[model samples]
Target: MIYLDDLLAATEGRRVGPSAPARFPAFCYNSRRLRPGELFVAVKTEGGDGHDYVADAVQGGAGGVLCQSPPTNPTVPCVVVPDTQLALFNWAAYALRKYDPQVVGVTGSTGKTDACQAIAAVLSTRHTVFRNPPGLS
Candidate 1:
């Protein structure tokens, strides 16, 4: 779980509304899938504005909202940041800090998939391997 104070320190965003939970179980960008005690990040996507889902997120029992603009008369704690996307990145970085893991990046104009697979195969001999497939966010 991630604490509200830790999120506040990592994002450096202004808080609005009532007191937040001691900690959140997870983070989510989609209000529809958000669970209770999860932090919801309002990301403006080409599909639609995430701000439009703030009420849904709150009603879904989101513990907090990381928003670029304040939610309309927010009832849950809302952290107002300059950019919600950047705040998301910051929050992810903060969450990753709890673990010490070596990361390998594979990039090339050709044979990128083969190269990544080969690297993972080699690394798996000594360490657990987790390869992130392309086009995943």
Candidate 2:
């Protein structure tokens, strides 16, 4: 689990609330999909700023919020980074390293599912394998 304070320290961001300790097992963006103990990364976009959704995310049981700027609300712990997308990618890379799963990179203009299935079929014979469902690409 990742602690909210540690995440703030890692990003050197300002805390908005009481600074109480909180932990989360995963990170997410969509408020609707946030779990009870998940960190929500609020991404600012051209269409609308994610900061507006911080309150909603917190209400949905997000343990923490990651953003490029401090949110107006002061009830939830917020981690401010230079860039939300970069921070998300960095956090994902760190988490993936901790899991240490076999990484398979696939890129194609067509038939990506077929290729992945073929690879999974071959790899499953010798090693425990997990593949994304077809059409997920």
Candidate 3:
């Protein structure tokens, strides 16, 4: 499900912030959540640059970093692109194609966690179900 080529293509015309060497992502991550071997995407904010967290994300076990600029960490691999948010969307779309799993996106003002649990309970009867951490609620 790894699509390095697509990721590279998506990074075209991106800016290069201070970064480290190139590393492959073991997984995909949002700016707020990172995982080992994950590619962290840093979106620009009104106050500062998203690339600022590149170093921290790497320390958290991210395999690669996607930002407007290269990362400051020497060991972390980075891909520079023009827009981090767009890149994130592109990367996600690419991931969707690669993984092609039964996706269940949920959003609500209340009872979202309960709804998710209900769905998981129902699905578990027929298939293996993996639920998000309870704290996510």
Candidate 4:
């Protein structure tokens, strides 16, 4: 679990608004797929700024939000950082350090999906393996 304090320390962020969840099971940037108790990352991508959909994420049951700019009135807990994208990266690095997960990367023109699944299946028997979905890469 990713604790709120870890996020703050990793991203050098500050908490704002009401209370935040003590720990987050996962995070998501897409409001359409956000689950309850997950942190909504408001990243500014080429197509759109996630900050624009903060409310939508909250309405969809986001437990907390991470953003560069705090909204006027956020119903859920929020974390303010200098740069949301950078903060995300920093938090990722922090998690890697804390968990020390053995990272693996699979890349190929073909058969990558099957290879990843097979590898995850093998690893899961002895370790906690995190596999990225086919389209996610």
Candidate 5:
């Protein structure tokens, strides 16, 4: 679980609305799938603005929201950030820091999968390596 204080520090965001909840068990981007006690992240995607779904998420029992724009007369706690997507990445990075594990990032236009497999194989010999590539559901 993540405390509101820690989340505010991680994303460098300010809380707007009622006081934040004590903690959240998960972070979510979609209101339809959001579970109770989960923090919703309102991202502005090409398809639609997640800000539009904030009410839906709250009604669905979201604990809080990370958003670029503060919702008017907000009911739940909301964190106002400069960019929601960047805030998401910041949260991920901050969460990873708690584990104190060495991070290895493999990025390239091509050969990423092959590199990941080879790196995972090598790392597995010395550490319990876990690989989560993008596009995994």
Candidate 6:
């Protein structure tokens, strides 16, 4: 679960719309798959703008939204940030820190995923490591 206060601090977002829940069960980018109590992320992807589906997501029972803008006459709580996508990433980083305080990031032009896997393998022997690589589903 994600707490509203932590989410706001992580994304540097402000609340809009109605009073929000203290926590969100999870988050979803697609309205079709959004579950009740989940936070819907309004991302402006190349395929489509998630903002267009806020109503549908609300109707589907979304608890709140992490978006660049709040829907007009909004029915649910909204966390408005400068960039929705960046906010989501920030939320992920914040959540990970909440679990383990200690975090290690591997960055480079190439072989980043491989490096992560290798690092996880080495660390897992002594400490549990959570490694998420690109393209992971």
Give per-residue CA lDDT, model 6, range 80-135, as digits (tens): 99999899789888887876646887777888877788878999899855555343
* Highest-lDDT candidate: 4
Deviating ranges (above 4 Å) for candidate 3: 10-33, 97-99, 117-137
Every model's TM-score: 0.69, 0.63, 0.58, 0.83, 0.71, 0.72
Error of 3 at 59 (Å): 3.3
User: 117 in model 2: Cα distance from truth in Å?
Assistant: 11
| Candidate 2 lDDT tens digits, 57-117 | 8888877788877766656677778888887666546646666788897898998989998
Give the Cα-based TM-score of candidate 3 against the true structure. Answer: 0.58
Candidate 2: 10-residue stretch with minimal lDDT: 5-14
Better of 5 and 6 by TM-score: 6
The clash numbers for all candidates, in the given order, read 0, 0, 14, 0, 0, 0
- After superposition, which runs of candidate 5 have C-alpha atoms over 4 Å from their true positions? 99-137
User: CA lDDT of each candidate?
Assistant: 0.80, 0.73, 0.64, 0.85, 0.83, 0.84
lDDT of 4 at 55: 91
Please identify which of the two predictions, 1 or 4, would achieve the higher TM-score against the true structure. 4
**What is candidate 4's TM-score against the reference?**
0.83
Candidate 4 stretches with Cα past 4 Å from truth are 111-114, 121-127, 131-134
Model 6 TM-score (2 dp)? 0.72
Tens digits of per-residue lDDT, candidate 3, 1-137, equal 33455677654634243333244534443445776776676777887766777777877887666667675534755677778778766766766676676878678788888888888889989986545544454
Residues 1-137 of candidate 1 have per-residue lDDT tens digits of: 66777778788988888765667777778898888988888899888889988889999999988888997777888889998889867866875685556878766678778788778889999987656443331
On the 0 to 100 scale, the lDDT of residue 15 in model 3 is 28
